[model samples]
Target: MWRRRAAVGVPLQEGKRVLSLLDDDGRGSHLFLLNVAQAGEAGLVGTVLAVEAAAHGHGDAPRFECKVSFDRRGTGWRQSSTFGVRSTNLSGGLPADGFAFVAPNPPPAAASVTITLFDISSGEPGSALRPVLPRSRRSRTRLSATTTAAAAVLLR
Candidate 1:
């Protein structure tokens, strides 16, 4: 099963927030408002959000989420996913053929999501997954941080 957490009504005021995943056994994923909608339960398209291994889990398990948006009239299908993979795996575990939902257009409004991996084994998030719930909300944006970078990062 997949573990998901979300952040809505994000202030698109030009900044960043850090989404930390403290585990690998699970992952955090999101769908753009538009992408979540359906035009008859067919998903309207046959595309999947491409989640790079780098966007899956950190360390050996890589934990991350995919973001997408849907639109009324069913004209949009945008897709975007984020996660991290084990630093040792140059291939990122997931094959290059992997795919996910893509948002065709920018969100009509301000919204963001963050999924956290919980240790089903411990009935809570694992050691790698920390800062559970009420995800961090910052006013600054920064580039993706590699394993070498600090655990904290800014999101936009």
Candidate 2:
């Protein structure tokens, strides 16, 4: 069975946010979002609004694609980023479980974001995989601390 966790609505600065997708056996991949601030003082910064995964194709050769939507913070702009794992290579074979997160050519500004995990093989929306909020104050604190540390590192 495959299992995954997501951390959504994370607040980040003008840097990168790294998200890890973990399975039941503690195996998974990482997705990253790079945030870029506006130039000078006139343009609006770019921000990520949500991330979702869905199955592409409908037959035996279906593949997985991760979609990320951007929020220009009210700048009347719409941008999307996609990541995918091809089901077949030149050798006409399926590769092992693999994933990647490619940053947009021009990074967007920092903003709140949501991350999701889905299984492309199942061909069903994995709503059950949505992350549940930490129930305890300690858990929230720990998550915050970790996120802060990660942000610091990425901003450097």
Candidate 3:
């Protein structure tokens, strides 16, 4: 059976955070921190963060790593990138003050990837942003595409 794996990261400290990712076999995935969390911060609790996902080839070695960062335009935290089969850290604590996530390499072609800035305090992960969100982006993009296609059809 083809199965999909997922991971959720919660910042326990400034640089340190806990990653709870699921393996394809439905086992507990590996967890570590390149940079330990700092003390006296909001941590992952109720904080906005990003998420990324990717798939490389098939069996092992090409694991997915999610990197989080604050959005551009001084907006909010959002998923910056996803790299295949590499170690990463949420450096600088989810990219405050208009920061970005830097990926070491390009992701796989068949990889499913996304970055989400979520506020867990709302009882829903990735559900507190206003003005713009991933869904909004999709909706707006689809709308624009539809409008363009309609106009083209009418012109034809």
Candidate 4:
């Protein structure tokens, strides 16, 4: 959930348009432009969509995707994103880059309007991926990447 703002944009080439967005408008400072079949007023909104896929990443690592979809014609439209997170090496950390694109105005899915962006992120790696301290400060927790084991430590 986020603030909704209208977009002010000018036309580019045929089927192409450019628009502006405010900070975190789509969850980041970037606004994605789409090529629409027909031109009209446009705006941007932010959302978080859970995208899970098989190991389609380099080294067969897991992917952590970030998405930014559009509400075209006031309906649900989107541009999907993909991610690659490898924590096998501690020095590498679980690095993740931003991705998501799922909006094409008009039919054919060839045209795009414009949309905002949200940031993408992943965490560091450690034992069982890593140990997370409970906010209650009463226990410590860990989750195995393989999901075969989970651990929790009670702290007093």
Candidate 5:
């Protein structure tokens, strides 16, 4: 039961803003910042924030996957990247400007994860952004969970 605050608005540039995720204790995992361009072209232009996980090699660390989408008046570009398990407490930068999205990998079974857009200049979070988890991915997770449960039962 991780408690997280709603997305906060951060100004990036004219007609553009970012949203950031904060936790109840003013801490958050998987923080993201979006940079929207003036020509309506947006991109992710931030770095990955520190989010302490349960423990390393205990299967408690959180997984993350980020995707960016660009819409240029009909033509669009989409790119995605998934964070590896070995990637922990690491800092990385995103593109300077673009429309992008970030999500928790292995999406929570029942809990909701927050994705925020933050402005680098103002140092504040902006509106909330919802990036849907693909149905196929969700199903795969369910299957894996069921399989793991069955295996544990057998071992017992």
Candidate 6:
């Protein structure tokens, strides 16, 4: 039994959220995946964590919903995801690999994806990724995810 919860178009303030997803036995064996498609000055710091649970074999639990409530502040909550994780579909556990949508990259194993969303507000699409580039390279107009995606980076 695979489990995934998707809360689409949800707004999130500038801060952190710790979601405790565990089975009835209080065990966890899931991975975290994030995607951002927002405008303006926005950034996210997400940490996928796992603590010692009572057991580690409940990886195939049924659909479970994690409900959390918090008081909204003034503003700055951007439209975010109803994050979905493939607990049942992926069999053993999450894969430690990147997504390949087309030819440059192969098709995705699962229907999950991670993208580096940079603010193209600066006009140059890659401007957000390389905020501190030298004056000698400001005339170039290219859009490679702007580098530092490091090994996970795909230059499409």
Evaluate residue 135 in candidate 5 and report its C-alpha lDDT on the 0 to 100 scale. Answer: 64
TM-score of 3: 0.27
Q: Work out the TM-score per prediction.
A: 0.27, 0.35, 0.27, 0.21, 0.25, 0.20
- Cα lDDT, all candidates: 0.30, 0.36, 0.27, 0.29, 0.27, 0.26
- lDDT by residue for model 5 (73-143), tens: 23333334323212232233332322234332322333222232222222322212222224674343321
lDDT for 139 (candidate 2): 60
lDDT computed for candidate 5: 0.27
Q: Report how far residue 136 has shifted in candidate 2, in Å.
A: 12
Q: Lowest summed-lDDT stretch of 10 residues in model 2?
A: 147-156
Each model's backbone clash number: 47, 1, 8, 20, 15, 2
Off by over 4 Å in 2: 1-19, 22-63, 81-83, 86-115, 127-138, 141-156
Best by lDDT: 2
List where candidate 1 sits over 4 angstroms from the true fold: 1-20, 24-88, 91-94, 110-156
Ranking by TM-score: 2, 3, 1, 5, 4, 6
Off by over 4 Å in 3: 1-13, 34-62, 67-79, 85-156
Cα lDDT of candidate 6 equals: 0.26
C-alpha RMSD values across all candidates = 12.2, 10.7, 16.9, 17.2, 16.5, 19.1
Which of 1 and 5 is the better model by TM-score?
1
lDDT of 6 by residue, 21-140 (tens): 223122332222332222333222232222222223335232221112221234432222222122223234533432212111221222222322222223432212212224574455
2 or 5: which has the higher TM-score?
A: 2
Instruction: Write model 2 residue lDDT over 17-87, tens digit each, in one string.
Output: 53444332345443323344444443324332112243232223433344444445556655555554343
